[model samples]
Target: AYMNEEAVGKAIRRSGVPREELFITTKLWVQDASYEGAKQAFETSLRKLGLDYLDLYLIHQPFGDVHGAWRAMEELYKAGRIKAIGVSNFAPDRLMDFLVQHEVKPAVNQVETHPFHQQVAEQQFMVDNGVQIESWGPFAEGKNDLFHNELLQGIGAKYQKSVAQVVLRWLTQRGVVAIPKSVKPERMAENFNSLDFKLSPEDLAAIATLDTKASLFFDHRDPNMVKWISERKIHD
Candidate 1:
């Protein structure tokens, strides 16, 4: 139950891991960003996940009644319904505004990050605020020939790891927590294998040079993109 929340639940149920020992996480979409909406949406996700307590709960986007939602999140935190609260896709200015205004600091900040669009400045800002940086599109969604990046390929060859694995290791080495999505169990095992090998400082520096300062996905800094997303439902 608690762990078997979706199709993935069946696999977790088979893994024999106890529910209490697992750190469960799920997101609250922008459509449900309001006070009442957040309350109702969370319950639905809880029901879907069969989770009694979410290890982490995040605002899917920085748009909408975020301040109001944050208040409700603080209330939830105090009541122990959610163990931790955070925001996803929030840039420095937006994060700063909320951090300065909210009573409870967010434990994490999930962002669109990869070697191509590495958000070093934002990550640094989050670090300054004691917020853990989590990567959303850790592999860049295969955009910009991420698999063919010569630098990454060379580094991967050196470690006997795939470019994807090398990228995940680079993030972990930078103290960033990554949640790479892959519906395949073999790929999931490969993703988790990053913890085994450490990236050298030289390798870290080389990968750092791959940053192009642009997002393959929507740019949160763009007002038009924000407006478009704000108007649409989460998957609409």
Candidate 2:
């Protein structure tokens, strides 16, 4: 897997955190997205992570035999192999179709969400339909000079926080769950500390203005991009 689940498993062991205290989530990748494939892939990921059960399992993308994949996931969830099952990068229309076809409502929809792509409408749709909207790129991967945004910078200054913290606070204020990427211990601490301070109404409003309402990254719906992502073979 791209994330190297074996290393993650080792780290979890080293941390000595109790399994019950940690919420683990993993995804089904593009190649193994059919009913049979998903079942095997889930076992593979579970083995790599050294876990008996997953807190959540997500279909990594909207491509492939998603219905088949969901059927497999639904079975697993009902069987208690996964506590919850969801999808990623699924637009409202596609999600609606899934809701119509499947009895299980996707517990969450992971997507590209940041100040740049606020996904206001999408989030509302998910909220109404009882699905959580989890953000994938809360910092926009530092794209568009996010670290140096004057608006976020100014807000952070008021709270003695970094721009990264301000963005995370903004997302949290909007009821969006952000999963920001961090490598070093210091950065991870900084990300966790973002929840320490509350952004004022004015600050939240200012951050709202930063929404471009479009993805800073490539559109998942674009034909060429979808084709490329759908065809990618990350594992055997």
Candidate 3:
């Protein structure tokens, strides 16, 4: 996963970016979901990332013995080892169940969000729980012609921006934290440029209409899908 102490340390040193200004994030895989396992995993991640502390640390999935992991996260947070704790790929029901039992409230819920699978209900649920919504595949993993869609293209044309920028702006306007992935410098700059433009109410509504109530990937609600995910090795 390229997420080890040496790799993170090397990347940090070569990144030439100030650590203080960046919102550092890392995840705890399901395989490491345990009181001791989560504690060890976080410490290892910190050592790898070459950071004294993390801005946010997330549980990577809903399955596994996360209740036990949450305990460790709470301890780490109390000790000031991590600033914020969150979860990823957790459905609203599962998240609520966790919240009911955990002492500390989660700061955020990271998920796969885009026009195709806008996750309106999930986002609303997180909001109600005071958990921020952080998007993982904000671009939907380049599936379903996201970049070439006519609606998105038209919106981009109006603002003289790329489709990517329009989508990012829409999410940001909705108060969603978007982490768009891009390897190229130009694309990275373009992605960050979403902050410069704003999508109008009408445009936001139009994008909302683009929601097909479908995900380009597996449906987490399906029991088979959940089972499949549960069986997959975190390290595999």
> In every candidate, how many clashes are there?
0, 0, 1
- Give the top-scoring candidate (lDDT): 2
How well is each residue in 86-127 modelled by candidate 2, as lDDT tens digits? 999999999999999999999999999998889999999999
User: In model 3, which runs have C-alpha deviations exceeding 4 angstroms?
Assistant: 1-5, 234-236
User: If both were scored by TM-score, which would come out higher, candidate 1 or candidate 3?
Assistant: 3
* Candidate 3 backbone collisions, by pair: 5-48
lDDT comparing candidate 1 with the true structure:
0.86
lDDT score of residue 217 within candidate 2: 84
Model 1 C-alpha lDDT per residue in residues 25-90, reported as the tens digit of each score: 887777789888788877877777666678899998898899888888889889999999999888
How are the candidates ranked when ordered by TM-score, highest leading?
2, 3, 1
For model 1, the superposed segments whose C-alpha errors exceed 4 Å read 1-16, 234-236
Of candidates 2 and 1, the better by TM-score: 2
Candidates by lDDT, descending order: 2, 3, 1
Per-residue lDDT of 1-236 in model 3, one digit per residue for the tens? 23555776787789898987778788887778889989988888888777889989999878778999999999999999899999988888888988899999899999989988898988999988899998889888878899998989999999999999999999999888999977799999999888898888889888988788777887778899878777766454
lDDT of each: 0.86, 0.91, 0.87
